[model samples]
Target: MKLAELAKELEISTESFIKFIQDFDLELSECIATNFDVKKDFEKFAKENKSFLKKYDADLGQNKSVEDIAKNIQQPKDKVAEILEKDKIKVYDNGFYKSSISSYGIHQKLGGNYQFVYDYFGKKTNLSERDFIGYRDLFFFISKTLDPFLHLAPLTDWGIHKPAGIILYGPPGSGKIFWANKIAEIVDYQFKQIKKYYFGTSFVDGRRANFNDFLVEMMKEDKVLLFMEEFDVIMSERSEEKSVSSCDEETKEIVLHYVSQFEKEDLLMIGSANSLVDIDDEILAPGRFDVTIPIFPPNAHERAEMILHYLKENLSKDAILMKILETNNAHHLPFWKEISSKMKVFSNTMIIDFTQSLKKKIRDIYLKNSSLKITINEKLLESAFREAAAKLTGEYLNQVAQFLQDVSINNYDDFPKRIEALKVELDSYKMVEKPIKTIGFTHNGDQES
Candidate 1:
């Protein structure tokens, strides 16, 4: 839809749409000469303009002209032009007036919607619950780093080095790959997934040399995120002495050179590895990876939420069983997915009974092994659910929940003292949990056991 067509549809005048285009540029010939279909161009322009106008609606209400609004927003004229062009608004004549179509603008186009790998997974595949602590922090850090570049001209230097690199290292299934994809989506950067063979091949075969060329071309395209999974292949520490024939030193050297180039050019680079301990120290030095984040396994609270989300999508009726199995496995995504699939195969009534039986089995297992009783009361369960939900949503509500859960579960003997200590820490965040009151002893009546 050209801006004029959109305006006509919305009952807006041609003069108004032309004025919007003029705010971006005066050269109508160049703007409309590009090859874009009128409807597609108009849709693109409408989306971008909606976002921009919403952002600066107050200023627009002041009745400023397009030029004045662009100046006030500090956005480039080309960007404004792109937005207008997307809306099907175009320059007629040199400055005179004629109606014609042209190419759509990239800047005005909306990036793809936020998506997750689990979305594409089979319905039967139960994805593990996500641990929100690391995910939220990771998102915040990346957002802060990329915010400056999002709205400005591609040419404007945000002091971002080409090939800007970030390393995410942790255990497998710890959400490293998921986080990388999410970051690319959030930042509106193109993600190029690099394969392991690209790094593992012998230099003599030209594999090592070809990788560098590929990266250089990718960087030149501007605002691309190069994601290297299993980065350990290229970044593992070199042996004390050089190894012969089978080992290739050229691969390491080529990787280092490109990494250095990326750092210098300001291109974004993101690498994922199962363990940082095995990675070479040289690759982790300041310039190569400006930031390193660890994606740790999910905690109890996160597990609960992961279970809940999985159940809602896969087994909506079996809430009780979902909680029990999730708490027991609380380790990774696959387990949740697996159990959920099983639960779905059974009858609804059977699902409830099966969940109860599972909970009993888990409790019996714990009871037989331990000297101390680990009771999960309503209060504790509620706390875990809340914490997990907050993390999943990327909200930082109470920082102390994680610490308390760790202390309580890992150190049962000292739980009381630790809880007291945690209370002091929680005070800092204005989070106060009442002490669990002991009403009476067990039915045995031996001092209310």
Candidate 2:
């Protein structure tokens, strides 16, 4: 959005606005930046003067009547008159006193000065085509929350509050952080991240001030999305742990403050974590994260698509690639599409790394080499994928199984008994170590069949 486009929407003369910005002490370059914040200066200016809004708007447009001003400002007509009287701003006539007399006023006498300065910036999202690998239903459900009637008070009659926040909880590398920012972009809200460890002594004492500033600014917008990554660092379930650290106490205080404001603020707060099972239930109760979404490592079909996302640029329609992916044939895809799918429970990050290494391997061996034998070393790619995939799947699966166990076992008296009972079921999902895990590769880059 350029200054000229902004001026058209603001209905202000570009020249006058350029000069008026000097009042806020902003350089011309700063305002021209992509999606800059002008409210900070506007609020400062408004506080400095009692009758600034009316005077500010009037300067840009015709002096608006009481009814016109009330409608434009979204205030009652009577309140407009009260402000006029309180500020001593007047319209002169044969006798002056017009609030009780007429429905409309003379524009010239009113002094044309109306300007629509109150802009609650909220960008509507148009993100149907952007794929986050999978989670198709999750994105669709989130997008539906942006309906015009989503904020309507009438819907609350059903016992569901208008969605104020959504929590995305899943194992690490499930791409919770990616989806959070994607949601922000789709909904056209300014995305801001909250750090994981602010409660430590190394952190500033005025941490609450920083939070207040962000929350206050967020409330100013019609829709704003705040992303808190790795939230469990401070918001871990208090009941689960007996001892409360100073950091946890500070986090509790900060969360409580926002909980109070959540009801009134028009915000779409998104919090992401490896798992929210540990996060305090109170912070997410009901309207807080009215929608608690669970994201898992991509399924087999999703994993294949994810691999194609990175490889499609180089190898979608290649049959050898599909063979290495352990598929008979790809119905629709590029050459790099068929890397190895034998690797299970690999995070999207791991797939990305795996695919990148394959591309690099191809570049180094086949694409860069001048030899007549331009065959891909299937065994090398398989080895890389196996090593990467086998890194954390076993450990993470154990954590997930343990978390499920924790959710079920409520009584401390029978905690160990319940865990032991779950141990078998948990082990079934765990990856058992095998002796022949590595692929046999020859100098020619082919597997020894």
Candidate 3:
């Protein structure tokens, strides 16, 4: 029904009716004749909105407040207030305060529809639980630690608090970020990337206030997975040697703030860094960031999994996946499997690089020599894999590989020092000079190293 008609029928003002429609996050261009007709389906929409209002009312039953309910439901009270809007819900005369979501109606909306909720906030990737390969032991560790509170059990009946913090320390492209994201996906929590760019402002007071406000806002969410990459930049152990910037002090405050929250809230902070030892002792102790994991290069089986995945993902358009899987063909699944077996201890990035290089090699050949046909066969992929493996695994080159994975471009000031340190570390091991040998893969998956 049109706003005027609905208002007249219900004996309310037109402004009031319009306000009701606006509650559902609808924007009006204002009622020209066509604009009014465009909203003809308002009746059905209003019914759904009525249900949400009813749920909100039930949530507030027995004169319960938003803050109490927010704590009970693990949602930020401010977020509840935002969703409920100030018009429909009462607000404090002085200012805003924290709140939580306590209504079962909201829970009904939230229970099985995490993706929907995240979609309302913003769309997530289509990556599912299976899409996250490896990290089996780490997954178990996370689940075991968080099992106490990572459920929908009633708060009044049982004791529950925010789960312990987790630090995923690894070299770059070791899958720390990917695993953290997958964890958030499976847990069905709000996933937020703690972008360093947000803290790049120069004004001290503004920086401190911004950090404080953002944390306050984040706390209101029901369940949040905060992923901080290059985490040591902000949360590294505060040292007297460092320059005294206001943001430094502010960063210290925020780190301490999250530590306290982790003890009693539902938020989970997942930070990734080059090394766990770089973090402060207090933060790494029993309660805050209790789990410090070291993710290393993938093992043989894991490397194989990653190799097959990337190969299919990038080269599938050329029907290379079929050649690998088809048993009757000379270059079949076992041939690929054996290739993956040989790629032991390869980093995930190296596998991706291998795929790109292999594809580029073929494309270059096709361009340079039009008469030579490029076939996506086992031998071609095997040769590319062999070539990449030789470069990544040789004695001095292995040290270089580690250096590339461990160092970030932002550490330009310390690059020389870091390189020297790594060189010394590599030098400590017995030096062995060996030829970079390339292995040839056969139809039967036999290889000569």
Candidate 4:
């Protein structure tokens, strides 16, 4: 069943259902496929909450003012307004709340119990079976940033136009491109990468090609998201100390020329950068690529979930690797948590490397002693961990530190927890000074023979 069909059967508007999802931070991709196939969990949730849906729709249908909401919910008008303000809800000139507000939302403001909803939909904060492992805070933050694109009320009533350009800043292997594609999916836009060759005058099939022409064609499409990597280099600040390459300068100029029209043309441009320090001030202007999201390496808890996810994704239940994991209880997240805690400041790429190395080591061990049962002991796990940790060098730590500084300046309040967690991890790599001892000369001054 499609979400629209489910909404119709339940006698509710699709927008109401979508609002409920947004309020709860549920990704439509998890509950509904591209072909509009609704997941069984979501369908069952809708069917079981028929009365709730009807009441939710009815409450949203009422165009209530602050006083009306206060009266209905038996809260003070000042309190109601404060809650709305805290949530970033905007009202009209007549003082009525936006259509996006609902009784469910008000109840949530009053601290009503909604664990049942999360329990039914599967908690987004925990380890989910979805493609991504964990980063509930980042996902929620990104969702809010994309809200203007999801609903017109933010744009129409609040003057919050969709972001023309966004920069995903983080260290390498932190999945900047992954979030770019995720934004494309959420907005129902076509995902297209702007390649290096596209920046230069290149030939395709003996035909002349240029970025300006390609961009014009892209704007002609219904809705499109253009992703460009190495954004820091391409949009580097102009300076006499370090000159920008001609190719990069040209590309930056072309983008600046067309950027103001992105929202009008139903287009969005996302830039992926390892660090934001080098991005030009013009590029970071209010109406330009002002919004910056910081992607961090997974923390210990998330690293464990990622390891378990990779293991399940690659190994079959009956495979030898699975057997060994089960024998040592390594198939579960708790077992991986012990080892993941040791991998301080490990990137998502390092987690993957650890899994691959572990698999190879296990395979080699099994081949050497076919008749013997292989135990997943510390020695085996440490060998793989050491190999993966090789990538966690001083250079990588410095990159992480730089990323932390950039995020602090750009988006500190939006993600303090992530920033703090990453800072702690990076601090773990700091070199502590030890007291040095002077050469011994005591009563045995004869060279301490």
Best by lDDT: 4
Tens-digit lDDT string for candidate 3 (269-337): 888876654566777766677665555556555566565556556344346333433432422234456
Q: List, residue by residue over 290-309, the lDDT tens digit for candidate 2.
A: 46655555655566767666
What is the alpha-carbon lDDT for the whole of candidate 4?
Answer: 0.80
lDDT per residue (tens digit) for residues 1-449 in model 1: 44444545655443444434433332232222121113344444544555443333233234333344346445566765555544433334443212222111122232222122113222332333222221332343444444444435333654443325777754444567777876777566788887655555336455454565666777688667778886765667767563422333555566677776663454677888655555677777876764665444443333433444444344443454445444545334454443433221121222333334445554565668652233434444333333322222111212133434433443333224324433443333332233654332121111111
* RMSD (CA, Å), each prediction: 18.8, 21.5, 19.8, 9.2
Cα TM-score of candidate 3: 0.51
Of 3 and 4, the candidate ahead on lDDT is 4
Off by over 4 Å in 2: 1-130, 144-159, 196-209, 239-244, 313-340, 371-373, 402-449
Q: What TM-score against the true fold does each predicted structure earn?
A: 0.39, 0.53, 0.51, 0.74
Model 4 TM-score, 2 decimals: 0.74
Q: Candidate 4 on 1-449: residue-level lDDT in tens? A: 76667877888987677667656656655665533467887888888888888888888878889888888777778877887776656578898986668757776767878777767766443233565766765765786688788778898899999999999999889989989998898789999999888988988789999998889989999999999999999999988899999889988999999999999999999999989888899999999999988988898988998887777675555878878878878777789888998887788999999989998898898899883378888998888888888787666777888999998888876666677777776765555333553332111001122
Runs of candidate 1 exceeding 4 Å displacement: 1-134, 145-163, 200-209, 241-248, 263-266, 314-449
Candidate 4 weakest lDDT stretch, 10 residues: 440-449
Query: How do the candidates rank by TM-score, highest first?
Result: 4, 2, 3, 1
